[model samples]
Target: MANLDAPATAIIGCGNINRGDDGAGPAVIARLAAEDLPSDVELLDAGTDGMAVMYRARGAQQLIVIDAREPEGKPGAIYEVPGDVLAAEPVHGVGLHAFRWDNALFVGRKIFGDDFPSDVQVYLIEAQTLDYATELSGPVVAAVEKVAAKIAARLVIAPEA
Candidate 1:
């Protein structure tokens, strides 16, 4: 059960805002910014920096991340992913951007030890056009609002997790 008196929940949005549908995270951030959130809830629009994600997730007890996932489905198909699922996937990359939420968790665990949040949820929005575009695709635009609302309902307005 969550300690009502010391609830530390953080909602982080991760993606490149300039890349078409890849901008889903920032879009969700935009929506959540318009709402009145609880004082205990922190919202971070962490662009493609995995280190930033790890740093921000350190102190929170519950963390929710929103991002545009690798191509896996039709655009706007939202997937609610657990941290373990990402950890199970093989990580192949040269630099920081290659490490995503799972990597963030791994780093956090190594550095912060018990201080890192164990409850982590990643909301993935499939992309259609992740090209050099600033605006989100038609489907991803709709999906952003849906995701933003659903996350808000689950974490912010709802009684508990």
Candidate 2:
């Protein structure tokens, strides 16, 4: 559990809800919202809004982002990656909007200077489908629940660094 005085661990779920499996991020947000997490752990459903994601996460010391991307393996596969990898890996073309996470980094750095979270983590889910729909695909929903449960459990036991 996090200390009451410690900076928060912010989790931003980024995705388009109308687009089938693209709703993965918000799905995780919904799952995590139902969890009993530390007071310092703040969750946000930053659906397709990179600016809101960055602005909402400004003061957090440790940030975790959940998002959906193209399939790299199985449909429901999940990958945990360091946030700094965004710079090395080009992800500008992954979404229907402008570069989300990557540009948020640039914007945060440019605007906030040094107060932005440095300990950033990203959870990527392999999306099976991304067509127009209100609900997530079955595989994506399973992935969201799995990742959300894992994150909630991890946060409950994880000591704030």
Candidate 3:
């Protein structure tokens, strides 16, 4: 079991819910809200608002961000990568959005100072399509559930309350 009193872990799910597979992150976040999670974990639905996510994630001991990525892998494939990788591997928004995780690094570092925790992890799920639709396809839904559970398992604490 995870310790309940650990420092907060910020889970920022970034995506546009109006899009199909691109909405996977926010979809997983919605599902996470329904589940019982550790009290120290703060969940945010960024919805392509990247700068707000950076501030929301500030001061977290561990930050776990989830987003959709077309990594050219199998659909529904998941990746758990360290945060520093964001600086090296920048991402582009799927459609008309201009915000991406790479920009969040600059904002985070500017707000949190240079030597933040090196343990931040980002989980990117492979997206099949990112159409501007309000609903997610069946496969995307399954992927969101799978990714959310995987992220929850990585949580370090139970309810702090």
Best by lDDT: 1
Which candidate has the highest TM-score of all?
1
* Steric overlap count per candidate: 0, 0, 1
How does candidate 3 fare on TM-score? 0.80
Better of 1 and 3 by lDDT: 1
Model 2 pairs in collision: none
> Where is model 3 more than 4 Å wrong at Cα?
1-7, 71-73, 89-97, 114-117, 156-161
Candidate 2 per-residue lDDT, tens place, 85-153, comes to 773433443443665766786566566766777888889999988888898878888889899988987
- lDDT of candidate 2 vs native? 0.80
Clashing residue pairs, candidate 3? 39-159
TM-score of 1: 0.85
**Preferred candidate (TM-score higher): 1 or 3:** 1
How do the residues 1-161 of candidate 3 rate in per-residue lDDT, one tens digit apiece?
Answer: 22334347778888888877888888888989987887778888888887766666666677778898873747778887878878442444333256566577655565466333346788888887777788876767788888888887877365568
Candidate 1's error at 60, in angstroms? 0.4
Each candidate: what lDDT? 0.81, 0.80, 0.73
Candidate 3 lDDT at 22 equals 83
lDDT of 1: 0.81
Q: Looking at candidate 1, what is the lDDT of residue 127?
A: 95
